[model samples]
Target: MNLISFITKHSQLPVKGVENTVALLNEDCTVPFISRYRKERTGNLDEVQIAAIVNFKAQFEALEKRKSAILKAITEQDALSAELKSKIEAAGDLTTLEDLYLPYKKKRKTKAETAIKNGLQPLAKIIFGQRNDEIDYEASKYLNDAVPNEDDALEGARHIISEWINERSDIRNLIRRQLERFAMITTKVVSTKKEEEKAQKFRDYFDWSESLSRCPSHRLLAILRAENEGFIRVKIEIDDDKALNNIENRLIKANNATTPHLQLAIQDAYKRLLYPSLSKEILRSAKEKADESAIQVFSKNLKQLLLGSPLGEKRILAIDPGFRTGCKLVCLSAQGELQHNETIYPHPPQNDSKGAIKKISSLADAYKIEAIAIGNGTASRETEQLIKRIQFKNPIEVFVVSEAGASIYSASKIAREEFPNYDVTVRGAVSIGRRLADPLAELVKIDAKSIGVGQYQHDVDQNQLKNSLDTVVESCVNTVGVNINTASIPLLSYVSGIGPKLAENIVAYRNENGAFGSRTEIKKVARLGNKAFEQGAAFLRIKNAKNPLDDSAVHPESYPIVQKMVKDQGLALSEIIGNKEVLKKIDLNKYCTESVGLPTLEDIIKELEKPGLDVREKAKVFTFNQNIRTINDLSAGQLLPGIVNNITNFGCFVDIGIKESGLIHISNLSDSFVKDVNEHVSLHQQIIVKVLEVDIPRKRIQLALHK
Candidate 1:
């Protein structure tokens, strides 16, 4: 079968769409470019569909590389039989390929390799043939003072056959499959260690075990953490007798002359060759699967966090809370322009509260601020209260934004560009305000992993987590169009085809030549290649473009079609925009072509209905209690309103006005079998819940979404 073609057929996208997009993506076309300008080229695949195809293409390429390496390694060892070569070539998984390559792989000298080198090849073959009449004679022919008696010669022959059994890829594959099915992961606490303070949470994990398939990612991560911290040892175990029986049923015969000899050989091979290797492989595979699952969970949470309520182009007062160092106050105008910057120490500006209030009020009244965005870091709540105590009849609404990566962004090159005249802390205040204005655009300036909404995010494979987060960010950026005039280089870089250099070029071109007149003008940016232009143009919207539709997310490719639709309706672009009747008459199917499909056409039509619509909703004003700083504040069955910080396969974590969020396990989701935690709750969702249990010392809070 044609592998790429086969994958395309099963994939969510059209075969030609995936194939053509992969080709372009491989040749350096940016995802945004292909998604926006190359609609006709890729059958109108959107960024999400195109990204999926690119990932699959990378996977297939990696698999092909591994296959070639396996084939070459075996052929070089002269162990490549015609049938074996064919089987190895046909194999898909790494596990199966490794199985086929086992015998050919270079290894440390073993008993079997030594015995084979001792000139007992013919005798070993004779004994394997299992001709009862010749077995004893064959054994006798090989016997010597060095070999001892018949039993000794027979034993030597068994060793060779055992090695062959171990070498058989089919046997190894079968055994691995069986172990995966029957094995139970058993975790144990190391009683040997004199326990330290931080290792206490893991103390209970030292002697815990669960089925490999059923183990939640968080649980596995916890156990792995304990092991790393030297608090426990973990192992996976299965019944060896049952495992042997399964193998014997497939590879050994009961009534042949070689039966006893084969059993001995097979048993030895299982111990010497297969079991240890397969165990390690299985554990590694499980860990990788677990990591991927967890990273995906992290990615979802991060995406939600990044796309959380935009402060909606409203002027905001930003406070990067500090006590001894004084607060960094920055005011961002509705258009994200830095209107004013200053510092006020409500806690210590020489312990002068009157002066601090006067300064804060002066900045607020000067900018006519609609709300205050306080970074939820040190002294954040105190800062919020200070702002709230002010006597404006309709006081500014205050929100506590997660400041996880705020400092990182403040110290970044992008931050330097936004605030060249201020300190890092002031830039952080600006970030907090901008984050309230548009989280996705601001968070992209910081590393996704640094956002800290994930479980064992640091412990998992770093490269894998990065790739997943990158995909999520790319998807989010494309989904929400960037303001070409207002977008920073960091936000611009994530557009489908644009990289750091191209992003800088676009910004430089804009700075040098003034604001972009239209999305098409991005072509003038230095080093902004055709591929980059195609992916990035549509997403980089110009609010006051030469064409009104350019401000809307209607791609350049769909412009002519939309223009025709507007003309046919006898309505101007503004007249029909946000009008349901006129939009209903615009046939989405009429625009469908080999390059543009129903999905892209429909999406374009919707974007036209609400031009430059902020995809994120406004987060509600949640009043958190000061009393519940930690899990110890909660009792069983106690009710509390909280924010859903994260959702994983096993459960959801709710920040119930506490330091440690409570877990709402999957079982408690609906009093029914909850297969996926995301189906019930999502990141940053406001939820009211009851605390089922709280182990203060362990810092484990079990919560239920019963309300």
Candidate 2:
């Protein structure tokens, strides 16, 4: 099939839609740009659907490349029969293609090749035909120096027949299907490493046995990790007798004297060839599936965390909490510029609460701090309690934020460039505070994997994980529009079609030329062209510009349409913007043109109603039970408020005011069956859960969600 036909069949999208999408992608259109602006062309396909089509198209092309290479290799060997060529050409997936080419594949010499060289081809042919009456006589006639006796000749004949059975596509395909359906995975601890300290974490999986198909993605990854570290030995297997019988029924012709030779050949083929090769392939495939599942989960969690609630622009005081190291504090303006920095020790070793409170209150008064953000690391609870006790001029909100990856960001090149004079501790405090004000803007500076809201992140394929996480970040950034005037370079880099270099140029132009007064000024940035503007204009918002549409998602290319709407309504540009009653009453179809269809018009109407609106909810304050500080404080059946910190295929981890997060398995997410843990819980979602069990030695805590 052709590329468009193949893509259409797999994606279930219209032929025209697939054709247009492929054309747009080939022309260098980004997913966010196409999904937002080219809705009419793609039948309103979302970014996810468009990305799926692109991935499928790439796979189809790769398979074709592999097919060409295989055909060339077989033809070079002078073994390319018409029937073989036809079968290879008709194959759909890699497995089928590889199976069809197995017989022609060149390999090192084996018993079968040796036997064939010893003049045993005729006896093997006779046994394979299974119609000869004098099988022993046929075998004896093949004796030579290499095969001195009838027994030796018969053995060689069986070896040759075994290879013939092993190479048949029909037999190999059936056996592969069987292995996929009934394979079992088992693990045992290495005797020498059983009591080692490093292996203690995987102790529960030492003697684990589970059906390969039913294993959870996280569990399988953990098992593989154990095997990789030499703590356990893993095996993928099926019933040998059943597999041999399956081949016997497919290959054996009849129950005659030759049947005994056939049975011996079947056993030899299975033991020596078929089972070992196919089992390895099955394991590799299963691991790939597991990797995909885990990566998808990580992607979802990262997206949610990146899009978490923002507190909007506000002057803030951020604190990186510690006991002996002291809490590093910084004051930031609404634009997140550092105004002041200091270190305060309110927890033990220097429990001068009165002096610390005085210092914090004086800084708040001096800098007009509107809110307080404290990192949820060592001594966070005490710092929060102390902040609440202080009497300030205004009621400043206190938020306990996750400090994961903050240190990584502090040591990063971005942080060093942004704050050349400040220390790493000061930079970390600033990031903590900036994330509370606007998460998407500050998070883009740090690596997604270091954010710590995922499971099995370090174990998954690195390139696949990066692609998935980058897509999620790109999607989130585009969804919540960027402020072109005040956004940092990292934030601007995620705008469609804009990479790091262009983002830097945009920032430099703004710095030299002042804030962007109009959207047209963006084109003046060096190296920016028409294509980049077209792809990135809609997602980049300029607040309070000379033209009102510039602050909204309305692309400048559609300026004529907007002007027509304003003239028809007999209203000024500012008057028509944010006029919900007027926008809601207007019929978009009357203004739809051949170039701008209903999809485009509908989006314009929506933007006019709520110009430059943020889709994320406002940040909220959550409080855990004061008495519970760690797992030791938790008791069975006691309910406590917590926030989800990480999610995996098996369960989610929650922070219930403890250093060690608690686990609520999929079974305990709700009373009913839950096929997916994310359906019941989300990243950073606050809820009440009951403690089910706690192990002090292992530092494990189990929780169950309340009804």
Candidate 3:
């Protein structure tokens, strides 16, 4: 299929409109530019659709390049047939084409090549043909070969015939497919060194066997961990009888007289060559699949963490906990405005306890703070204790905010813009406070993977991990929407059409010209262009501003239509926005099209149903154990309440007031079989559990779910 048509057929975007979009991207036009101004040309494809087209187009071009490479590789061997060349050229994926080319590709010297060079090719062919009862005759024909000095020429011919069977691509392919189907992955301890005794985590993996599809990512990763630590040698195995019989069936006819010898040769080939090669391929496939799965889990956790609710329109004092260097404190106004910044050494400051207490108390009093946001960092708990001791007449609530990616955000360009004259440490404190106030907006500023919300995140494929995480962020950002006027560059950057550069431009424009009066006013932002506005406008909110619908998710293009709907109800836009009667009367199909479907229209209707509503409310605070600091402190049968930080295929990790989270295995998630942990528990969910077991030295805590 032609690239544009292919994209149209496969993509969730408008096909015909994206053609021009793709051309612009190919010409190096940025997403921001095309999404904003070229709406009429693209039939109003937003930033998301435009970006999808760009990605698909690049992939299409790469496939063409791969096809050319495959043809060149085959043509070089002078064995390219018209039909094979056409088939390879038409192949969509590399794996399919590679399977077709496997036989003809250049290879290392094999026994068949040796036999061919030794002039036993004729005898080898005769036996491979499986002719009627002619094994002895075929062996006699090989007597003149250099190895013919052996007493039995027939035995020599058998060896040559065996090599031929091994070299046949059809035979190898049949064997590989059969083995993959029947194979069971076997993981075992190497037992080569005493190191495994010290590797307690791997002791349980001494001899684990799992079917390919049923093998979970975490389990595979565990075995890989053992292998990396030099504690285990892992293997993939197929039933020997099944594997051998499949190969024999393909190579030897049932009525053939030489079937026994062919079976022996096939068995020998499998032992010498096929088993090792196919085993490695299976392992590689299994690893790739496992990595994909792990990346998905990590992506889900990161997304939920990044999209955690924001405490909208609240003044906050965010403190980044520290000891010798001292804690950095920054206060933000109710509108996320930076009001004050300072440093306080709650520990070792001026070597006086009274002075440290006075410093933080004064700042809290001056800021009229409602909540004290303490960063969960190196000296977090100590900082929490310090805040608790200073019991104000106001009795402010203390929240231990995760400071996972605060440092990264603080050093980022957006941070520099937000706190131009402030040091990175000072910016970090502001970030921590803002995170408490608006977790989603503040966390979006940091890299999703760096959020520390998932298991083995750093070990997964970074690119795949990044893509999955970005998708989650995109979905979350779009779902919640952003305020165009108040959103930071980092927050705006993730909105539909708006990206890093465009988001910066919008923020800079706002800084230079003041708050956006209307979502349409964003067009004035330098370099934002049309594409940026089209994608971003629908997501950005303009509170209590001109055109009340602007504060809602209803896009500017759909504003008139909504107004028309409201007018049809004999009312103005504001009168009908929150009125259930007016909303019920509106038909989403009136606005539905190939570009903006019923789903998009329904979302707009829902937004209007709750106009200018703040999505973030106080999420239920999870209780952490007061005594437990880590897994080592836990014992069996101890019940604890903790926040569910992440969920995976095999288990859910509960941060039970400890540095290390305890795992509730899948079997424990419910009395029934829990196929997916995410279905049972979500990120930030509070759960109670009983400690099933804890290995003190290993620092592993096994937990069981509480009803």
Which candidate number maximizes lDDT? 2
My TM-score estimates for the predictions, one after another, are: 0.90, 0.96, 0.83
TM-score of candidate 1 versus the correct structure, residues matched by position: 0.90
Regions of candidate 3 where Cα sits further than 4 Å from its true position: 1-68, 82-95, 108-120, 132-170, 190-193, 196-198, 210-213, 254-265, 323-326, 335-353, 410-424, 586-601, 614-616, 619-638
Q: Per-residue lDDT for 1-707 in model 1, tens only? A: 25566457557677777777877877887676676666767887777677678776766677678888888888888888999888877766566777777778898877766667666667777656655645666677776656767787778777888888787777877778866887678877666673777777676775677787778777878888888888887787878887778777876544566677777877887887778878777878888988988998898898888778776788898889888988888898898788788777788545666787888888878889888898877777677778777876446788888888888888987788777888888888888988888888889999988887878898899998999898889878987878888888888888777868888888888889999888777777888777666666677788877788878777676788878878888988888888977788777777677766776777777877888887788756777766666555678977788888777778888877655778998898897888878888878888888888878766888989965
- Candidate with the larger lDDT of 2 and 3: 2
Ranking by lDDT: 2, 1, 3
Which lDDT tens digits does candidate 3 get at residues 543-646?
Answer: 77978888876678777667767777788777887888779878777765656666556767787889767655564333356677666677888888877777
**Which candidate leads in TM-score?**
2
lDDT of 2 by residue, 1-707 (tens): 67888788788988888999999999999999899999989989989999888888888898899999999999999999998888888788899998888888897998889999999978898888887877888788888899999889989999999899889888888778888999999999999999999899999899998898888788889999999999999998899999998898888878777889989999999888898898888888888889899999999998899899999999999999999989999999999889999999888899878889999999999999999999999999889989989999987989998888899999999999999998999999999999999988989899999998777788888988998889889999999989988988999999998888999999999999999988888999999999998999888888888888888888788888888888888888788888887777777788887668989888998888888889999999888898987678888899999999999888999999888999998999988899989899999999899899998998999999887
lDDT of model 3 at position 580 = 81
Q: Which candidate would rank higher by TM-score, 1 or 2?
A: 2
RMSD of each: 3.2, 2.0, 5.2
Q: What lDDT would candidate 2 get against the real structure?
A: 0.89
Q: Scored by CA lDDT, what does every candidate get?
A: 0.79, 0.89, 0.74
Name the weakest run of 10 consecutive residues (lDDT summed) in model 2: 586-595
Model 2 residue 677 lDDT score: 90
Model with the higher lDDT, candidate 1 or 3 = 1
